[model samples]
Structures are given as C-alpha cells and as structure tokens.
Target: MSVSSLALAQTLLNGALLGCLFGSIALGLSVKWGHLGVADFFHLSLTLLGAYLTYSLVTELLWDPFLTLAVTVPAFFVVGVGVQYLFHLIDAQPFTTLLITFALFIVTESVVSMIWSPDLLNLRPLLADGFTTSIRLPDPLPRLAVQPIDLVALVCAALMVGLATYALRSTRAGRAVQAMRQDAAIAETLGVRVLPLTLAVSGLAAATAAVAGMVVSLRMPLTPTLPLQWIGVVVVATMLGGLGRPLGALVAAVVLMMIQNAWSLWFPPQWAPAVTFGVLFLFLALQPLTRLARERITSGRTA
Candidate 1:
C-alpha cells in the first residue's frame, strides 16, 4: 500500500476540511456543556435536522445550499432557547440533563427518519451545475483538488469559532456567561442576568449547530443516523478541548481528523472508529494520573 506524496497531501486536506465541519458541530455542544452545564446530546440530532432541511431547500426549492443557513440558524436558535427553557423549568441537574437530551436525541432521530425516510440525501446534484467548482493547487502542489463547499465549510467553521470567541471575550453577555459557568448562584447574586444569558448562549450554540449541519449537507450525504457516527468523535473532541472553548475544540477536531485519515491509509475504513474511541479511552485513562500528578506536585511545593 504505497501512497504517493500528492495522494497523502490530498487526503490530509480533505480530512482537515471535514474536521472543520466536525468542529462546527461540536461547538454548540461544547458551549452548552461548558457554560450551562447541560450536556445537550441532542445538539447532534439538531444538526442532522438542519442538514435535512438544507437538503430539501436546496433540492426541492432550488435555493443555494448556503442560503439555507439564513433560515436554519435563526430557527435552530429559537429551538435551542426553547430546549434551554425546558431544562430550566425542570431544574435539571447535569446527569438529568444528559438523560433528557438523550431522549430528545432519540425523538429527533425518529422524527427525521419518519420525514426523510432513512434515505441518503445530498446536495451534490443540485451543486453539480457550476455551483461547486473545484480549485487546483499551483506549481509544487499541482493536481490537488479542493472542493468549493469543503473550502466554504472550513471558512464558515473558522468564522463561527472566531465569532463565538469574540462574543465570549468582548461582550457583557459573554462575561455574564463566564461568571454563570463559574457559579450560577454567585453570578446571579452579583447582578449578572443568568437566565437571559443562558438562553442567549444556548441559542447561539444552536445557531452554530445549524451552520454546521448546513455545511455537512453541502459536503456529504445525509441520513438520520449520521449523528450516531459523529456524536462520539465530536463529544470526545469537545471534552478534550474543554467545554466552551471553541478554538480548542476546532484544533482538537482537526488533529483527530488528520489522525483518522492517516489511520485509514493503512487500516480498513471500519477500523477508523477505533481511532476515535481509542483516543478517548486513552485520554480518560490518563486524566486521573494527570490530576494526581498535579496534586502531588502542589503538595511537594507546599512542603
């Protein structure tokens, strides 16, 4: 299985592009988990729903795929806010939120399956007529083909991360979000508008999911169960990157995608998932040791 240099480069490029979309999908989950302490597993399902919606809009309505974002983002934002309100109404704990959202995930998956009929859907046909022109690399990198939608997804993912970072760092609402994450009761006592901030962040996170889903529709075929494959890797990436850290999530996802691509070069495609969960298990196994080492070092310094 000798691979050419050009082939390897192209593989890596595709992996990176896909990783960017993965980062986009994970961003909303990371934000909600980090800030709101709600492990909204259903975020992935929402993303799939967004993809299905994008497919219908593009193929049936003859709209540009990217144009669907204008509709999905705001609609999903409202959905996110409503979901958050449900959490609040129930006063759900972290574990409870997980169960509730997982239930929602199942329901969403079922609904999408019912509506979309478990068929594999994509925007490729709609994009075939001059919409998705591929770009060629120049000189030393000639023959490396870059799909337009792949590039678009990469750019959109980066932009979403940047926007989320800016919102978190530069705005009053962001500071409120940070404070609330640290301690909701304390933040509330300190005059931070925790409720409104929670709703806003949740909505923003859902909006990110919508963008991610729209990108996914442009880049790959859609199915109701698509989220199952993504949920594990994205969740691992989100956790390893730290909750609410959009940039960290993006970097982790890209690296993971690269590793998976490299692994696929030598191994079977079915074995690729081993790479994702293997990294996850390795990280989880190391966490205790890492924490203990830090604790011992702190005690030694105190001595």
Candidate 2:
C-alpha cells in the first residue's frame, strides 16, 4: 500500500479498537433502556465514577489501574441496584424517571468536578507509552505501532461482549429477561421474579460500565466531564444498534468510529461530531421504514 493508504489503514485499526470500548459502554445502557424499559440517563455516571475512583485509588494507594476494578465493579453494581430500587419506589412516570436520572447525571458530574476538577487526569502505565517504547508494526504506516496493552484491552472488551451475548442467549435467566422485555406481565405470570431480575440486570449493566471505564483509562486521559461525552455517543450506539444486541452494538460502534476517523482525517476536526450525528439521523430516518418492510414480508410469508 502507498504511505497514505497505509496510514489510513492503521488509523482505522486504532479507531476500531477504540470503538470496541465505546460499544461496551453502550451495552450497559442498552440493557437498562432497551431491555428493562428503564430510562437510565445516569448510566454514564457509573463510568465517570469508576474512572475517578480508579484515579483516586491509584494516586492515594499506588494501586494498579487494572487492580482497581476489583473494588469499583462491585461498588458500582451495588450503587446500580440501589438506584433501581429507588426508581421502583417512586414508580416514576417515564418523563419523571428520565428527568430524575438526568438530574442525577448532573449531580454526579458536579461531584466529580468538585473532587477532581475539570482538569484532565492521565493514568500512568498508559498502554500507548509501552507501544511507543518497544514495539513497531511491520506495516509501512508512519508512526503506527501496536501496543500489548491495547491488544489486551481490545481482547477483554471483545470477550466481555461475547460472554454477555452468550449469557443473554443461552441462560435461563437470560430467557426470562428477554421475555420480560417483550411482555413483563406475561413473564411475571410464568414464574419470573421481576424485582430481583431487574436488580440483577441493573447490577450487570453497572459492571459493564466499570469494565468500559477501566479500558478507557488505559487508552485515554480521564476527565470529570468525559462521562457526559460517553452518554451521548453510547445513546447513539444503543439506538442505532437495535438496543439489546451486543453484537449489534459492536458493529454500530465500529461503523461510527470509522466514519468519525475518516471524516476527521480527510476533513475538519470540528466536523467529526456533526458527521457522527448525521449518521445517527440517517439511521433514525431509515429504521421505521425498515421495520415496516420487514413486517410486510413476514405477513406475506404467513399468508
């Protein structure tokens, strides 16, 4: 390949890896919003919480960033369960639930700002550093080197998504949860424990957020405001990916990231977010028509 072509290819690879992390973030939101029918506006808050907690622990106790997950994952899971219970008690209207969680997002962001400020905090042991230090890709791409840590993070994300998909497809609990999404009352009548199942799903969502946070920290600097960015991108991914499918989330993320990277490389940096939103708009415009055609085809098949 020519130099420019090689560079673009390398950039795309990096983008895909980053996209996997983004997809993982969306998985949690998809479960809460798509499957449970909960408006989990605060899903990104758990990610920010994990990021800041990891930062604090590493700074204070000198723990490894990977090791911090041992604490943050379970802690966030508990927090998620508590949040779900609170939502249940309020029996909130959809808008009210959305507003409450939006407010919670603001509160969490404010707290993060208070504790860590808006300053960018870079985690030590960045996988990039090691890649820059000792490794080089054989490709003729200028300044492109694959890092071991990057590979590790990408593999972990892929594995997590795979396991989540398998669980959703193969497990009894997974079937019950899927049934709940389709018809909550019917599922409850069939011996599904609604409350506990919801709690478990919520906890699982939080744990996913935690894992995403860890991967993100390894790859990029953490900022108090970063979670806000995640909320938007993840919401887009979830909606475009059909919400409950982990594999769909992964594909959506890769597509979005490729679009963003290609746009920014060939065009202006400021246009990247606009292009991402444009892709989302296109997807929204097409989805209903796609659904209608599918339904018509099914009707014809049955006829």
**Any residue pairs clashing in model 1, and if so which?**
none
Output the TM-score of candidate 1: 0.94
lDDT (CA) per prediction: 0.88, 0.80
- lDDT of each residue in 179-257, candidate 1, tens digit only: 8888889999999988888898889899888888888888888888999999878998898888889889988898899
Q: What's the count of clashing pairs in each model shown?
A: 0, 0
lDDT (Cα) of model 1: 0.88
Q: Write the per-residue lDDT of candidate 2 for residues 1-303, one digit (tens) a residue.
A: 234876787778777877888888888887788777766778888787777787777778988777988998898899889888887898866677789889999999889889888888887553335533535666664467665656756786688788889989999999998999899899999999999998999898888888777777666788878876666567788888887887787778877887788777778777777777888898889889999999999999999
What's the CA error at residue 111 for candidate 1, in Å? 0.7
Worst 10 residues of 1 by lDDT: 122-131
| Every model's TM-score | 0.94, 0.90
- Candidate topping TM-score: 1
lDDT of 2 at 90: 86
